[model samples]
Target: MQTKSAARNIFFGGTIFFFVIFVGLVAHSYSYIVTTSTNVKTLTEAVAHGKKIWEENACIDCHTILGEGAYYAPELGNVCKRLGGKDAVMGMIEARQENEEDTRQMPNFNIKGKDLEDLAEFLCWTSTIKTQNWPPNEAG
Candidate 1:
């Protein structure tokens, strides 16, 4: 019931409308990620160094952090809260002992000194991220 020119106008109008909606959604997502999903104030040198160490050692291969890695080990997203504090995390990492009775064991990566401290700091920082109650339990 519409002329060729009217049909063309409707098509272009619809395209523009959808494009604007898409742009608005993208902006919203970006703002949420920058402002709501993370705390920029807590990002420190120690946290960066710890993340670097985590990558260098391939910790993701055995453990899941924020529920992205393998499930072989306990989730470490909320490790700082669950384990008590940074000191407890550091202590656990420092004291890795192999037991024959245990079916699975965490191998000692020999992480120590400032590197160990940084790694713990990184995990503690990760605990502060807003995961919207992810892992669904305190154990994570």
Candidate 2:
């Protein structure tokens, strides 16, 4: 063990051991994410459509959901709670009116009909996900 080659061997062995551990952890995380993180029951047509709308409208560009996305706007993870349940969530989203006053702000997405309902439903569903406590702040 006192030899230089012995020391080098130990170093390489430790590196390989840590690398294996890291790889194992990554594999476990991937499996867990695939199997447990999402609740498939909550993933309905409405949630899918709502997710599509979110992507199409680039809502993540301004808002964070479940603490993921740009920080420019408030987090929509627990928005159903923040805004007060489904009706309130729907109200806030529906309240956006197009203003021609020349101001830099959240634009009117003009979400209407089923699309509006679906989007709100998606947010409500998101609030119910098992985050183990995230955003950790009143103002996300």
Best by TM-score: 1
The sequence of per-residue lDDT tens digits that candidate 1 reaches over residues 1-140 is 89999999999999999999999999999999899989889999999999999999989998899999988888988999899899999998776533446556887788999999999999999999999989798766
What overall lDDT goes with each candidate model? 0.89, 0.84
Off by over 4 Å in 2: 1-23, 98-104
Inter-residue clash pairs, candidate 1: none
Stretches of model 1 off by over 4 angstroms after superposition: 1-11, 97-103
Error of 2 at 40 (Å): 1.7
Q: Candidate 2 — what's its lDDT?
A: 0.84
